[model samples]
Target: MIRMQRLIPTGDPARPVEFTEDAQPVPAPDEALIRVEAFAPNRGETFLLERPEPGLMPGKDVAGLVVQAAADGSGPRVGTRVVGHPPRGGWAEYAAVPTHSLAELPDSLSAVDAAALPLAGITALRLLRTAGSVTGRRMLVTGASGGVGHYVTELAAAAGAEVTVVTATPSRAERLRALGAATAVHAVAGARGPFDVVLESTGGADLPVALSKLAAGGTLIWFGQASRTPATLDFFDLLSGPEGAVIRHFHYAGPNAGPNAGPNAGPTYGRDLATLVRLVHNGRLHPEIGRTADWSKTAETLVDLRERRIRGKAVLTTGVVS
Candidate 1:
């Protein structure tokens, strides 16, 4: 039995995480055993922890070294540094991940930086792709200072879109501009647009405002509910114009939504991850890692994340990289 430390849910909202010892996972024919160097928590995982069966592991993005290669020789080789999204969880010392969900990390990226990719990065990429070609299009990204929002701004700008960012934190405006956004504002209201594309994550009242900003025949991709509140909108009025906007709700792991996607889907996660890694390597994109802490501080980190205190992404290290 390979002894390893893993974070499990405690089923209590106030204190959601607890560490426990578990046997190291064994890799399958198409899976690789990773020695996790670092990992990041996602808001979606918080919702999962509220379930009755909260004892399961609770992380999705991880960066680590391959301890064991796939039995079928289909994934990364042993000793390769890789980042992956494990379906069950990843906040552990060792995890068994499907090869197709693993992306080899670039030499320049630290484990902490790579850990911040995967789910957030892939979600951002898919959001852009779902919005169709952004070349010369006028685009707006709500929650622009966030993990997915930052990436969407950068990627869209790189694709020749005139990117504007909407952020609750006023101080993040300059940083958002540095990330390739043509403009950054605290509120979506009063922003100049009839935007060609709107990638919205702030769900509550902002949803209707975002819908209103869309240009006729434009597209709006709603990908998150950061506000955790219900949004009210008059559908008839919102969709009344002759060139009504196209509204799409995107879930990265939704059925048949990605490459080779299935009930246990994630192959496309690896491909998108690889693309993001290349962009970072080539200096075309920079993933923001907001903070880093020891794995022992997992509870505090999660609280900060849940409380919306941290900016960009928060990463937890297993004391492997200094």
Candidate 2:
């Protein structure tokens, strides 16, 4: 049996998880069996546990060593180190993941860092790509201290954009500045911009404020609703005459077309993952891992993430070979 951290919903909203052991997974023809070493906890997973299923694994990002290659001769070979976004979920000692979702890891990256990369990294990368050329452009990234926000800030900066960040945590300003943000502010009202592009993640009153800052012909990409609050906007102000800016919403699972494909489709996942890993290896990008604990602390880790006690990314490690 594999000792996996299954999400056992307690039916109590306050405390909702219990870990249990389970049988080891076997890979299918198009799947790879990975001995998972580390995984990251995301706030999105909290909503998934609300219904309380019995034996559901609650992680999407995983990093580990491949113990069994796919039966159909796809993906990485056995004994390769990899990071993946498993479809059925991945908080376990072993996961049977689709070959298409896997990316080989470089020797320089740690399991914790790789585990933190898949969802947040890819989201940030793809959203910025959608904005076209960012070199010398003015960009505003809302929620710039959060998981995806930070990556967007760093990557945009690396692309030569003059990045301005809006974050609730002012204490993270200096760190964000070091990552290439020209300025970091606590509120959107404090930001200075006629920004060429706005990556808006905080959806609430902030959404309208973000919309107001976009320069003529600028594009605003809305990818998340962290506040779980609604925003009211006047149609006239949003699309005013010929100077009205553009607003595009982004989700990882959208349909594939041209270079803009869904996260799992075509060569998007593997290609993007490879580029991200290379950037990290070359010191061009950094994955901020805020907290890491043994997998035994999975429940507490989730609580910390939900309460906003942890900054950046929170990771859980198995700490032993399977």
Candidate 3:
């Protein structure tokens, strides 16, 4: 039987995440089994473990070699190095990844970088797209130094948007500017803007300010609620004027975005993965990975993430688990 590492959580991550051995999976007619070289946890994974699905493994971005192929042509060939987004099983030593979710990695990029691409990259791309054309527009990004937020800043800046970054901490302010912000403002200052677009990843008192900055026809897309504070908006803000705003919430794992999405959003997963991986491989874009931890230290990594001590991505290398 194939061996793997899995997480089983009964309470919050303050408790130890149990590591267990399990039988590795065999591919059905269309699924491929991935030998996970590296996997990274995202916020969603933490939410998953604390909820009803206590047995869920907390990683979606996976990079590794394809050790087994499907009977059909749907799966990758044996020994092909690739970065993939597996639904729930990626934190394990081996995962049965659906063929449609796997994207081939270019030889030019390292597996570590490849492992970092899919989740944050796809979310960023999707975030900007939903905000519509950003060219020459004024945009603001909250948590501009974060995993998805940094990429959002870079992507929007690269698109020629005049980006204003709102950050809560001073440490990330410089890096936010370096990521291509026309202005970097602390969350407390509430920078001036009739923003064409505003995206909030950090919430709390800053939410209304980010929302108010949006210009008419401008859109605000917020996903994460890391600030652990309540946010309320007044319709009077988005009601009128050329500088009025639009607000929308974004979450890839929601009704229209994730595994349970409808026919209209059918199979959009690998599409973004393909585009993001290609950009990384071509040296056009790169994601920031804060640190790499082994599977044994996965809980510690989660703690660091929760504490916001690390920026960008934190990944775990399984290192030949069998």
Candidate 4:
């Protein structure tokens, strides 16, 4: 067995993760073996790591070079540069990635940038697909400073939607606007809306306000609860909003969630990632990576992410590939 260095949980809150040597993974017939160059940390994954399960390993989004192609010849050939979404264990020197959840990267895109595109980018893509055409719609995005929010705002704006973003500070407000927001305000209360579509991720008190902003028959996609507080919705909260308004709970891994995760069919993670990469290559979509650091700082990085110190995606370089 070939031993490789990887990050593992320490079961200590103050030092939640530490590095260790583990046997290199063998790829499944439908999975490719990757020499991981970089990975991105997400708040949701970090929260789980804070009190990790006995065998849990943290990692979701990664980018690197394929050391071995899928045994069944399902994905890119060996030596291909790729970005991938593995179920877990991505914070390692090597990871076995399912072919369907991997996509090749262009030479122009760096491993760090490609690493930023998986979980958040795909979530944004599927949600936008579910909302249908934003070409002339009014869209409101809460929690607009985070990775998913940035993608939602930029993609909607690029599609000709009028985007009103809610952030907490002037700096973030400015960044949101530069990402294509038509308007940026300090609070949801500052947004005057009869929005055709609303992407509500920050839960707690703000969720009801986001609901109230939707136009009649408009859609509100609820994907996250970054506030870590449950939303309380009363009969009045529902009745006060426009009639026929819809609230759709979004899960990137839902049964019907495929490449599009919309009303359309045929969802594959590879195809969805490919679309995002193509958009990046064509200068149509830009992945906003706000923080980058060496892989040794995984524990501290998670702390910063939880404390709201990092603004967008947080990428870690593994130094496994140049």
For each candidate, give its TM-score against the true structure. Answer: 0.94, 0.92, 0.89, 0.96
Q: Write the per-residue lDDT of candidate 1 for residues 1-322, one digit (tens) a residue.
A: 7688888988777777889888888777989999999999987677666663735777789999998999998879999999998886699998899988899986798898899998888888777766778999999888777789888888888889999898877668888888898988888895788899888888899988988888888888888888888878897878574277888888877754575556776444678878888888888878887889998988877877777788889999998752
Task: Please provide, for model 4 over 1-322, each residue's C-alpha lDDT reduced to its tens digit, 9 standing for 90 to 100.
Answer: 9999999988776677899999999999999999999999898987787788898988989999999999998999989999999988999999999999999999989999999999999999888887889999999999999999999898999999999999988999998899899999888888999999999999999999999999999999999999999999888769877999999998877755565444655435898899889999999888888789999998888888887899989999986765
The best candidate by lDDT is 4
lDDT of each model, Cα atoms only? 0.84, 0.82, 0.75, 0.90
Model 2: residues >4 Å from true position, as ranges? 1-5, 53-56, 240-242, 256-268
Q: Give the TM-score of candidate 1.
A: 0.94
Off by over 4 Å in 3: 10-12, 51-54, 235-244, 253-263
Candidate 2, residue 78: Cα displacement in angstroms equals 1.5
Query: What are the candidates' C-alpha RMSDs?
Result: 2.2, 2.4, 2.9, 1.7
TM-score order, best first, reads 4, 1, 2, 3
Q: Where does model 1 exceed 4 Å of error?
A: 50-52, 255-267
Measured by TM-score, the strongest candidate is 4
Task: Write the residue-wise lDDT of candidate 3 on 89-167 in tens digits.
Answer: 7878887777888888877877778788878887888787777789999888887766887788888888899988877
Candidate 4 regions with alpha-carbon error over 4 angstroms: 260-267
Q: What is the model-wide C-alpha lDDT for candidate 4?
A: 0.90
